[model samples]
Target: MNDKHFDKIKNNDGFIAALDQSGGSTPKALAAYGVPETAYSNDDEMFKLVHDMRTRIITSPAFSSEKILGAILFEQTMDREIEGKYTGDYLADKGVVPFLKVDKGLAEKENGVQMMKPIHDLDETLRRANERHIFGTKMRSVIHEPNEEGIKAVVDQQFDIAKRIIEAGLVPIIEPEVDINSSDKEKCEDMLKEEILKHLNELSSDQLVMLKLTIPTKANLYKELIEHPNVVRVVALSGGYSRDEANEKLKENDGLIASFSRALASDLHADQSDAEFNQSLQKAVDSIHDASVNKK
Candidate 1:
């Protein structure tokens, strides 16, 4: 969060509206919430996870359906992968935009060019984001054991995909996922900045509007975020992040969206019930809601 980007994004309201949160609310959270841990074990586990999450997404106070456009529609990503949850038309009816994540898994061929097909189902995804005015394509650049070539490839392919997604009309939420593979915090931050610059060089400034990252919670990380600008509206991931981290990211700015998943489902890691997951999500949701109110 460099000062330049922070101020840049903070200056734009439309950019803030571009945030799309499609993560968290797991079946594990459900079990811990009190639906009985058994609900998630048998043949019915997947079904229950889906059903409970959907119901809670619309009804729960934790979920700000009113403020946010539902995620891109899908079972896995509707929460994480951008499932939108609602059908494209349904989203339109509610006056809420849809967001799609375009990822073509990864390369499988041993000697093939390792290109990811984010816009794999191009025609359909284009129709969804464009015709529907879906917010944009929030890209994921995975840094899993990534060497220089791998990192560059991930950045290159994903950015190229971002270019296409924007040309198609949706905005781009460039997410360079930083995890264990990213090594240390300095490396993680540097790589992320590099990827953004690379992406900007190709996509230019006008076509992009979002920065979706799961920033780390270390104190230095906090200082690092303080230095960034809000070039794109910010949205922090739900899990793998701490409140301190989010506060640092959003304090320099506002109008950002944060996913309320893992943090909400903490106990669920131990494996709880549907009721438990709901409760976790509920708490997570409330935390965000409260933050929003405070921001007001």
Candidate 2:
């Protein structure tokens, strides 16, 4: 991304609604919407369900304005349009930036940690993102505990892809999600933070990176990260928290904002009334927004 595009993202500082659910995530969300598993016996059927959900989100009034600065879209939803216009164009028209998820999902454990599968054809993906007028990209890899070796592996691989993403002209949101259920949460956060600093300390003066981390047990645990020269913003994922629980925890952090998917769309389902769905979405957005900007 150019300086102007990067500035656009940095200047907003608003919550990002992560709607980038892949194949594995799509079924779970659809099941919650009352769609039976037997219905998705085929890929086409599953695609339709995902498409409908994304269309609902893009067209929702709650997502149309400035309250959401950006959204991370799945590959399938990347090409879909709203009102005969491209999805990215649709978002831009409504004053919301659009980002694409480029990772090929997670691979099996390596060194006791799950790593993000390498992008199969990242150059082409970046080309597609550029064609779609996307502003940035997000990729996820999980850190299960405070294993130093595992944390180092995750951090190294994340930044390795980040460099290519930056070279391709898209800002990268590096997500090394710490398992929220881990008992050693505090130690995990510290090691992860240190590993992050190791990468940031090596960045060129012109480089800027964003982080999407699990909210640490201690509020303001990422203060140094938020203030880092090469780090533009720090956002939090809900991980497995409920809507209310996520908002409560998010409020405790001074600088982190929400980039949540489940928390943002918690109670809304395909079966709900449009009014009901919108109400839930609005509630999620309002609570998250209020908590993120309301410093302790």
Candidate 3:
């Protein structure tokens, strides 16, 4: 990324929002939001529905405000048009940096954990990010517990891809999401921190990275990460927490900001009245924004 583009997003104090749902999840997410199952019975129909839903979010009142500094989009939605302009361009016009989800999805488990599957066409993906004017990218891998081998596997994969993304001149949000209800949550977090620091230590000062971890079980578990010189910012994922619960968890951390998906869009439903949808979305935005800004 160029200095001006990088600084534009890096300096943001507002939270990030994840709106990227892959093809497999598109039908389910629409169904959960009360879109009739019949409306998205096939891939073609489903893509349109997902694109429409993304449109709703981009055009939502909350999206125009400073509370949302950026959004991560699915490939299908990132380039679609909004009011005669591409989606990413539209977000930039509204002062929200656009990002893309570049991972293919999780791979089959190995060593009792599942790591993010590599993007086979990463060069093309990064080129697309640049062409679309996207500012960053995010990929997810899941850690079940504090297994040393498993953590190493996940971190190495994430860092490998992150190096590629940084080389492509876009930020990478490395997400090794620990299951929120894991019994060894605290230990798992410590393992992640150590591994992340080890990888970061090898990078020169010019290379930077971003993190999107699950809400730590213990308060300030990510403090060192937030303060690390090579880390641009640290944000937390809601995983499965409700809005109120996620907000509370975020409040306990000193520097982590929200980069929520489900928690950020928790109460919005397709069946709701327009006023109700707006009310719920604004509330979610305010709660997350408040938690992020209060840390500063």
When 1 and 2 are scored with TM-score, the better candidate is 2
- Whole-structure CA lDDT of model 2: 0.85
- Report the C-alpha lDDT of model 1 over 9-114, residue by residue, as the tens digit: 3442221222222233244445544555455565346544554454445444443444443444442333332234334444445444455556545454222124
Q: List where candidate 3 sits over 4 angstroms from the true fold.
A: 2-5
Residue ranges of candidate 2 with Cα displaced over 4 Å: 2-5
Residues 64-171, candidate 2, lDDT per residue (tens digit)?
556787889988788887789888888888877888988898989766578988787999999999999998999999888789999999999999999998888888
For model 1 the TM-score comes to 0.61
lDDT of candidate 3 over 221-289, digit per residue (tens): 889889888898888898989878888889889878899888887788887877888888888899999
Per-model TM against the reference = 0.61, 0.96, 0.96
